[model samples]
Target: MLIPTRVRPSELDRLIAAVDPDLRAPLRGRVDLGGTPLSRATLAAARNSIITPRPLPAPPIAARRIAGVPGAPPVSLYVINQGEPGTRRPAILHIHGGGYVLMRADDTFPQLQTIARAHDCVIVTVDYRLAPETRFPGARDDNEAALRWLHREADSLGVDRSRIAVMGESAGGGHAAMLALAARDRGEVSLVAQILVYPMLDDRTGSRRMPRTGIGEIGWTSAQNRFGWGALLGVAAGSSVVPSGAVPARVPDLAGLPPTFIAVGSIDLFVDEDIDYAHRLIDAGVSTDLMVLDGAYHGFDGAVPDAPVTRRFVASRDAALRRAFTPGGWRRG
Candidate 1:
């Protein structure tokens, strides 16, 4: 597939320059995953190379372990509180995106701290179990466990139970979407909103024969997507039998879900699925806000933080979050 000639020249330049040379070479045309497969070791090495010691927040965020449901493993939750000690603040349950296979809870602390300070809310980043070793529902269970723990200990943690929201990027976003559905079905918890940042929502997305989006050319390729989903599902990607909870796009209904905020680049691999999900949410009578960045690709905001497109993306996301956290701002569906 040829690179979309429709991409703005300036954005295309940034995309090419930001991607690694090796990746840039393959991105000019269709990528061959079979020739260069993504392995667990390779992914781990890449993650380690980028991992750095993040400085503590000014007031310091508390890090602690909380027990998951009776038999589940204990999960790590990073609590960022910028409000007064006793004041109940709106909370955001943040899930980090590593295709559901890589990255730790602390990898998201920098952004969590920023959001916590910006919104003056309690931010909790959950270190959910990763895949291959732990399959479907294992990671989801850990996230749900953290949510239950937060609500149960709300008073003590100074979190406003009524205003809690779930937010995440990529696989994390997928998890947030599933978590919202599960929470609704179980009738155990209520959410003010769900912020899905270019969520990886569909398994079939990996098999779709689509033109190369410059963004997917380098980072997060279809082959990688296949590996990630396969590891998480314990089955091949695009398998005939897969659980709706594991793949949000498969869910038959989008009703009863909280107001949703979805942002994706026009050229992202998940673009179609994200847009379709947004339309479905609106059709289901859910208040949905969708932002499609022109001439952008997957993880564009993080990949080029200072780019004009990225700045706009960050601003839009922060605005959506602020509105959701505001008292009585979210209209229950």
Candidate 2:
């Protein structure tokens, strides 16, 4: 975390004014999430209070402990199936966000229930280990194990293995991206699509490259971003020799990845990095859809679920998942 816990006065001079009308109330006069650098000192409180999101009612959620990666502990999973039993359908391996340092999987069951019912699809939300205590490959391995378990049990779970997708928000988005990449490089599991909502992609974002003005002044800030990255990697953020297959943004080749749908707020710190990642995906001949909401900030969809921009983001995500799960497969741009 940087000195001067709150955002600099210069950054806030225009950042607050640029936020969406509906999204301004939460940011108005607020010190951008307590104005504290996320450290072990503040991590506990942030985990308990920072993830206050409004989600829908959930169906009966079945808890299961599945086998983990070799030599690792078992992974926890929440399997939700809204479709008829024995009816094969599309599935989404949903990963929850907490900047790779906070939050849990089951805390988001309410929202997962909505998606499962709406799509009549099987959903498997993973409980990947968080950072600081568990770093880098720990969470990634948990997700990979869950993905493998899903693919392995597709028949018994009434899921169509060919139509599975990976999705997450914020840090969860980073995990989803990493899972997609590992799935590709390992050739063990094939993903139909990747839906990343305002994902934290690059460590260099707030470290090497200064955050753009008007963004990161609210919600998740550069200071938090730096801490989050360092916690995950167990090293300085934007360090040169990170472990292989850790950071999605640092992966050299983007070709052969599944179709990707990315959504980011206009004033979210990740807007530029997400857009650039989308561009690179397109350049790699992959089908990529990017939705940038105007006057929105990080996590605005959850903050103001009923806002117009939020609705648009939700619609785009659903539509992208639908297309990817189609029988014929996703259509290229």
Candidate 3:
């Protein structure tokens, strides 16, 4: 694991001080959890303690670049040049994970910066508009435009358009998948690959009940998933009918998409959908890699970086990205 060890005793002291004494037991007991999705209110209640988010250490290099200045709406840009430079490097446009509601390019700065530098690629983190405020297509449009912008200005940015990949986590992952589909359909932009981490693929809920013993411990719950999807769709989540662009699962066709790396924690709310989506991609003749992390949940990589499970998660992710971005990409096993 590249992550430095965070002393549990010291970290727990900070967590205990931040949280209510009464809830400490349950939070500490969460070292083991089954697949059952925890309640949103419960998770929210423990946010201050159990789910403490520490910004990743700063990257060695960093910069920002204007991605797009569409005459309509706001001027959107890409945060670029934050990694070590490599000759004939591949470029990746990253979409930050937030269930499509919160978080932004800047919020995930540490992780993105690390990725940019580690991969030695021109990593561009796009600032997509959030849902409810911007609605469905708005976010997708920004993503597509960013890819188009990447292609159009590839020369200026010293990136190879042919080596472009789309990467994101959670809802951002879903958007990255959708962007590949959209780009394929419109013939607007070409993508070399996509990396989706614990992606929330379906707007609709799944019938399979969560299991009780693995990554389910500290991951997002069914309730949280509902809230996120509802907020993004502007309607109750798990609706029998979802409009296009609202959910990747609802998209009619899955053909002609780019190669994809789909990752999910066994206990994640989107686990089922992520699995099914990967299968669908294979069915459509699109190359796909599916990585199922055991004893891990949504945001596990960021949540408990010190855990052995999460250490393997990050290592796997890095290796996957390296393979995906390698001069000649490899196929899934």
Span of 10 residues, lowest total lDDT, candidate 1: 1-10
Residue 74 lDDT in candidate 3: 50
Q: On residues 148-169, what C-alpha lDDT tens digit does candidate 1 reach at each position?
A: 9878778888888888999999
| TM-score of every model versus the real structure | 0.87, 0.93, 0.77
Model 2: lDDT equals 0.84
Compose the digit string of candidate 2's lDDT tens values, residues 94-130. 9998788887887777778888887888999998898
Whole-model lDDT values for every prediction: 0.78, 0.84, 0.66
Residue 299, model 3: Cα distance from true site in angstroms: 0.9
Task: Give the Å shift of residue 19 in candidate 1.
Answer: 11
Better of 1 and 2 by TM-score: 2
Clashing pairs in 1: none
- Which regions in candidate 3 have their CA more than 4 angstroms from the true location? 1-26, 29-71, 82-87, 206-217, 331-333
lDDT of 3 by residue, 1-333 (tens): 001112344454543343323323434633233322323443333322333235455443344444433643653555455322233567888887776766656666667667777777777777788765667777887887778877776776667777888988888898888787788788967787888888877766532244343322244655556666776777677777766766888787787777788888665667778899998888988788888875455676665556666666677777867777775765632
Give the poorly placed runs of model 1, Cα more than 4 Å off.
Answer: 1-36, 82-85, 208-215
Best by TM-score: 2
TM-score pick, better of 1 and 3: 1
Q: Estimate the lDDT of model 3.
A: 0.66
